[model samples]
Target: MGDALDIMQIAGVGAAALVTEMTRSSWDSMRDAVARFFRRGGEERAEQELRLIDTARQRLVDNPESGRGPVEERLHRALAIQLEAFLQAYPDAAEELQVLTDRIQGTNEGDSGGRTTVHHNSDSQIVIAGGAINASGGFHYRAPEGGR
Candidate 1:
């Protein structure tokens, strides 16, 4: 909230929620709400952003089920960056973003039909359906002590 890193985290999580909502039946409502938030830039900027959002939605819609994981991940990352910049310019809007994030994620959670459950994980396995999972950076492993 008070620093760049915190803002980035909020933006990242918020963007993930937004992208996750894109595939839901209630997308239009959420999309319009997001556009309203972007209207801080101006009417024209808002329209342009909405078009980009529509294009991202189209990409999600066009991809086959199995191919959607990567596509969604890409879209989530892009939106996260955009949201981070927006928050940087308008720190006061973080609360508004929280409202959007809560609403979007709340609706998604309320729908139990499309939920995917993973049990007893032993490795890094990702099973993406129509939601966002934000993971960044990479893993580096080193043998403990003299084990290597």
Candidate 2:
């Protein structure tokens, strides 16, 4: 909306949000936020965008392999193009687009609104509550390729 480069950058951020957040637990909220942004166009346009988002998510759910490969890249490009066109049509919505993108990034970073401190010495072991673990002064063994 501001310029060709700015619009493309905004679209890239939007597309990255869609692609990366689609498989995460926050996806429903992310999708709804995206729909709200698109709703600037109109009800019909918002619904159509929602459908496209859902279709992309469904593809990932139905075929997990595609989520990390060429299919994912294609989806990113498609969404970026769609968003760029939308921004071109509605130039004033660029600010809201940036806010939404920031929200997605913040959510992904686990916004707990507090500081977490970890104190560890060379021989210390630690485990955070949410699926994170560190073992110090030990031989580390990697898992097998196929979910061992």
Candidate 3:
């Protein structure tokens, strides 16, 4: 009877340890996913804003009179209008992206915004960010599944 009781206690302790490890891993994965979501969202907003800027620039070059005031003035106004529209569309995501783009464009944000780093622990994160905006947005990390 004594030997049987000791064996049962050992088994219980092992099971508890396994559960703890699994829980920790699961929490880590959840945190990673949230981070990836925010990073990708920011990248998407930045890309859209950039595209708008390009389009506005081309329009200013092609048809100067139709835009706004002077060529440079028109370009600035158009860029601002387009960015405002984007922010309206995706308020939460656009806020961060606008900051990033402003930094990249050497605006008054004081960001020096050319460099950005995103860390992810899975290939899926890469696919999600890249496939959407056609830009490399996230850092890859070893996932729990060990696939990538």
| lDDT, residue 98, candidate 1 | 83
Q: For every model shown, what is its TM-score relative to the native structure? A: 0.72, 0.71, 0.29
Residues 1-148, candidate 3: write the lDDT tens digits: 6634443443333222222222232434433332332444477765664455445545544653454236555455454454345444545544344344333233222323345566764445433321135437855556677453
Q: How would you encode candidate 1's per-residue C-alpha lDDT over 1-148 as one tens digit per residue?
A: 3588888988999989987788878888888899888888789878987888799889998998788999999999988888888888888878888888998777777775575777886545455645455648754445458642
lDDT by candidate, in order shown: 0.82, 0.80, 0.42
Ranking of all candidate structures by their TM-score, best first: 1, 2, 3
Off by over 4 Å in 1: 113-148
Q: Could you give me the TM-score of model 2 versus the true structure?
A: 0.71
Worst 10 residues of 1 by lDDT: 139-148
| TM-score of candidate 3 relative to the true fold | 0.29
Error of 1 at 127 (Å): 16
Candidate 2, which segments miss by more than 4 Å at Cα?
A: 65-67, 111-148
Q: After superposition, how far is residue 108 of candidate 1 from its true place, in Å?
A: 1.6
Count of backbone clashes, every candidate in sequence? 0, 0, 0
Better of 1 and 3 by TM-score: 1
